[model samples]
Target: MLPQDLITEILLRLPVKSLLRFKCVSKQWLSLISDTHFRHHHRHASSGVILCRRTDIIHHVSLAGSNSDYQPFTSLCFIDDSAGVKILQSSHGLLLCCSNYKLGKARSYYICNPSTKKYSILPEPDYVSVSDNSSVYLVFNPTKSLHYRVACVRMCSSSFNSYQVEIYSSETRDWRSSGSPFAAPFDMVFDSGVLWNAAIHRISPTGASLCFDINQERLGAMPGLPSNEKWSRRRLRYFGESGGRLHLIEIYGCSTQFQVFEMDMDYSSWVPRYNVDIAPVVDTFPEMLRNCIVRNDFVLYAFSLLCLQEDEDDSLLLLHIPGQFVSYSLRNRTFKVLNSISTESNNAFQIGCFHAYQFMETLADADQYL
Candidate 1:
C-alpha cells in the first residue's frame, strides 16, 4: 500500500479534472476531497473559477498548481444538444442545471458532476397552481447538507390574500406545503435551508425591497431599509454571495451605481455594506445582464455583443468580449478584473433561465459509501 503521506502529496497535486475522475476510484478518496477542511486547502491552493461559460458546451478552469503565472487551463466540452446551460449555484463538485426549452414548458433539471460526466435527473415538479398564485419559486443549497435538499416556495391562492410556501427535503425526497400570512409573487433567495422572500411592489417602474425569512419552515419579515426613498426606489436585487457574506445588490433601474447589503447573522436585518458601479453602456450586453453569477469574491456580469475591428465580423466581435467578471475586496473597497469567458460557438443554444446547486459534500464512512 502507498504511504498515507505519499497519497496525500499526490492527491493534493492532482488537477481538479483528475481529482474529479478519481472520486469514483473509491469512496475513501471522495470523502477526503469533499471534506470542508480539504476544500479550503484546495481553494487557497487553486484560486479562480473552476467552471465557466454554458453554451452547447461547459468548461472548467483551474489555477496552475501553486503558480502565480497565468496558465491557460484545459477546457472540457459537454456537447449533447445545442441547448445552453446556466449555472444557478454551485458547491463542491456537483452542479445543478435547469435546462428549459420552448417557454420552459418541457423543462429538465439535472444534477451533474461535469468532471466525472455523471448526472442524475430530478423528477418533474408537481405542484398544483391553484388560486391566485401563478408560479412556483424553487431555491436550492447543495452546500447545506450531504444529501443536498432542494427547497421550494409556492404561491397558492388563499382567502385572506396571503401566499403559501412549500418545503422539500432531498434527504426525504418529498415536498410539503405550508401557508404564509404574506401576500403573492414575492422574490426569493436561499442559502442552505434559510429562505429570503422579498416583497415586490412596483415603485413607478421599480419594485419595493422588503424581505422575509423562512427557516424551520416558518416565515417572518426582515428589517426595514435604511436608505432614503432613493435607495428603496432602486431595484432591489438579490445577489447570492458577496465577499463570503450573503448579500442583496440594490441598483437604480436607470443608474450604473449599486449598493451591497449583507445578511445579518441574527437574520433580522440587512446591514448596508459596499458600493459599486459599471459603465451604463455595459448593460447592452445581454449575456452580462441575464445569467451572471457571484463567487466567493467576484461578480460575473454577462455582455451581449462581441466586436472585432476591420475584418470585424459583427457577430464575432459582439460576442468577443464574452463576459466580464469583477472581483471585489470588502477590506480594501477595491475591484479587480478576474477573467473573461465566451461561447465556443454562437451556434450554441440559448436558455431563458437556469437552476443551479452545488453539492454540499459530506464525510464518507465505510458504511455510507455511494
Candidate 2:
C-alpha cells in the first residue's frame, strides 16, 4: 500500500467522476475523498460547462476533453410532486434553483451541488409581497469559505424606483436584510445578475448597469462601455464572467463583426480583447442565418453567445446557432462544433429557447455549513 499522503496527491489529480466511484474501494478512501480540504483542492483542478435547456434539463459538456456527452440530472427531484423547478443561476460548483409558482403552493428556493447529488432547501425570505418583483442570485467562492450566500434584489413596494437587497447566509442558515433601499431605474431588471470580482453585476436592457459588493454590502453604478455614435443602438450580445475576468460583447446594426471587451480590475474602463467576425461561421452553417427585417432595411441574424473561456494560449467563444453549439478560437480565428441539439423534443432549439450556465465539478457539500 502507498503512503497516505502520496495517495491523496494522486487522488487530487483525478476527476470528480472517478473520485466518486473510487469512494467505494474502501472506507478509508471514502473518508479521504469526502474530506473538506480534499474537496477544495479537487475543485481547483477541474472545470467544465453545463447547458440548461428550456425544458429544465441540465447537460454537462467537458471543456478540456473531446467527450461532449449530455448527463441529465434526474436526481434533482426534491420538491412536491406537482411543483416544477428551474435553475436561476450557477456559481462555483453550486446551483440556485426555485420552485415554479403554483396556485396553492408557496414558492421555494434551493441550493444544490449536482455533482454530489446533494441539495438543501432555503428558507423563504422575510418580506414576501405579491406586488413586488424579486430576483435571487447565488454567490459562492469555495476558496474563501465553505459557506455561500444568496443575494436577493427586490423592488420596494412602497416607494417608486427604489429597490431593497436581502442576503441569505448558509452559515447562519437564515435570511437578513442588507443595506437600506436604493434608487434605480424602474426598467432595470435584476434577473440575470452575473457574479464577478466579489460582486454581483447586472446590466439593464436600456444599457444601465449596477454592481453590488457582497462583502461590503453596498450597491453602486458599474461603468458603461465607451461612447460611440456608430454603436449608439447596439444590443448587448453577451455579459458574463470567465476565468476570473468579466467580459462584455455588444453588436450593432446587424453586423457579424464585433469586439469583446474585458473590464479592468478597478472597474475603470473596458479594454477590447478580441475582435470577432462570425461571418465565416454563418457562411459555413448557412442554416444559422435567419434574416429578420428591421425597419424594412437592416437585417438581423439569429445567434447567441453562450460562453467565453479565457486561457493562456487561445481564448474560446461558445455560440449557439439554431440546433448546434460552435466553439470559436480567438487567437487562431477557427471554428469547431462543440455539440448538437436533438430535434426529438417538442420544443424548438432556437436562440431564445435555452440558456447556458458554467458548471465546475466539485465535492462541495450542500449541507456542510447548514
| Model 1 lDDT at residue 251 | 50
Q: Which stretches of candidate 2 lie over 4 Å from their true place?
A: 44-46, 54-56, 63-65, 70-75, 78-81, 126-132, 229-232, 290-295, 341-348
Give the candidate number with the greatest lDDT.
2
Clashes of each: 19, 0
What lDDT is reached at residue 253 by model 1? 43
Model 1 lDDT, full chain set = 0.42
TM-score of 1: 0.57
> Which digits, one per residue and each the tens of the lDDT, describe model 1 over residues 208-308?
33333435454454455545555334444434442234555555444545666766866576787655554533554455555665544445444321111
Q: Least lDDT summed over 10 consecutive residues: which range in candidate 1?
A: 307-316
List model 2 lDDT by residue over 212-291, tens digit each: 88788898777877546344466787899987999999887768899999899989888998889999998988876654
For model 1, the stretches where C-alpha displacement exceeds 4 angstroms are 9-13, 20-54, 57-86, 91-93, 103-105, 125-144, 157-163, 178-182, 185-215, 230-238, 251-259, 275-326, 333-335, 339-370
